[model samples]
Target: HPWVGDHPLSPKSVIRDMYERALTFTELVSHYELARTEGIVLRYLASAYKALDHTVPDDLKSEDLQDLIEWLGEMVRQVDSSLLDEWEQLANPEEMTAEEAQEKADQVRPVTANARAFRVLVRNAMFRRVELAALDQVDELGEMDADAGWDADAWGEAMDGYWDEYDDLGTGPDARGPKLLIIEEEPQNALWRVRQIFDDPNDDHDWGISAEVDLTASDAEGRAVVRVTD
Candidate 1:
């Protein structure tokens, strides 16, 4: 799409706004990707440990995690082989020539390695959680009381106040948690906004572009637009 006039809402300006919104959406989706990766790592850990005849440590046994794993296992077992094959073909695209397939595989190899590294980090964190729980049990000290002059409520209020101020500074849980919640609550609505600008035919706004371009098409077009305008 070309910007032909001096209009404020030119094609370039509209594309920029769409790009920013899409970028924000992708950032939100990345948080869910991390969660999915964690679930995959957990499943791998459970399966590997079982295969090795290792007992699941009591401290490491989360009921929710176990339930998720069992549900995933059942889902996998119930998947139709034909449907699985069709999904694999759709995802991998067997129509590619040998060279194209190899190039694609080469591109994916680094991503596979990166995912493996992330899985290792997640596994280590899981082990660390168990270790921390064990240490907390070993070092168990009873709660503070009036005899010790440590008012539990007052201490809690002070800590809460500190954390509340920290959160106000945007360095606490509220920073990401609320954003994720907002995006996740109605993800289809967020997606619909993007589609409305770029794909919807009856929309008022026009970006002066052909509809149904690939998601990554913006990168090359954006670079071209910048180079020409600069």
Candidate 2:
């Protein structure tokens, strides 16, 4: 009688409902895609970095590297070049001319305290002999640091093995080949296509494509064909 008075729903029903609420990988992938389209991924990554106590570089404006350069200019103005070298030498305790030491320190100082701390992390990787893809781990570190309970000791404990393992594996991410996606729209039509030749992501050199079309033909209804290619 007492148990019946306290609740109306059965425990089995509650458990089943809770299990149904869990997200599947497909649902998660769909959510991530939507978030990516809405720029939610950028915001999430930025927030994650902030939570980790990791310094985001001032220059990273939504993942752009130009912001880092702009901030570097501003941050460098107040810096006494001579003092920077001293700090660097102090950090490494290496013997060198004040000027030389300052140069080294100055080069590295602009990397501190900004939203793209991950880039600095990549640079740090070079010294430790870590692969470039390990840079991707920044996302995880950022999320951990962003947590309110994170502290220096926790950071050390969490990152120590991560850093060590990366140092031992000196490979980078797989090469992302070239690919292009083109999207075009007309008054009455839409077009999308993927062209293989121009899609190589690693190709720094550019090549032009030739197009032959009759200009005199009337494209009635302005039915333009838009093409999207990846």
Q: Which one is best on TM-score? A: 1
Off by over 4 Å in 2: 1-26, 29-55, 61-191, 196-230
| Cα TM-score per model | 0.18, 0.17
Tens-place lDDT per residue, model 1, 1-230, is 13212222332343223222222212322533433343343344334324322356656756433533332222222222232233334556767655664454344122112322222222222222222222332121112122323244533443344344332222122221212111111223211011111111233222211112121222222211000000
lDDT of each: 0.28, 0.30
Off by over 4 Å in 1: 1-95, 108-127, 132-230
Clashing pairs in 1: none
Q: Write the per-residue lDDT of candidate 2 for residues 145-183, one digit (tens) a residue.
A: 334333345434544654453443222222212122121
lDDT of 1 at 186: 26
Tell me how candidate 2 scores on lDDT: 0.30
- Local error of candidate 2 at residue 127 (angstroms): 32
Candidate 2 local lDDT, residue 163? 47
Error of 1 at 144 (Å): 32
Q: What's the CA error at residue 98 for candidate 1, in Å?
A: 2.3
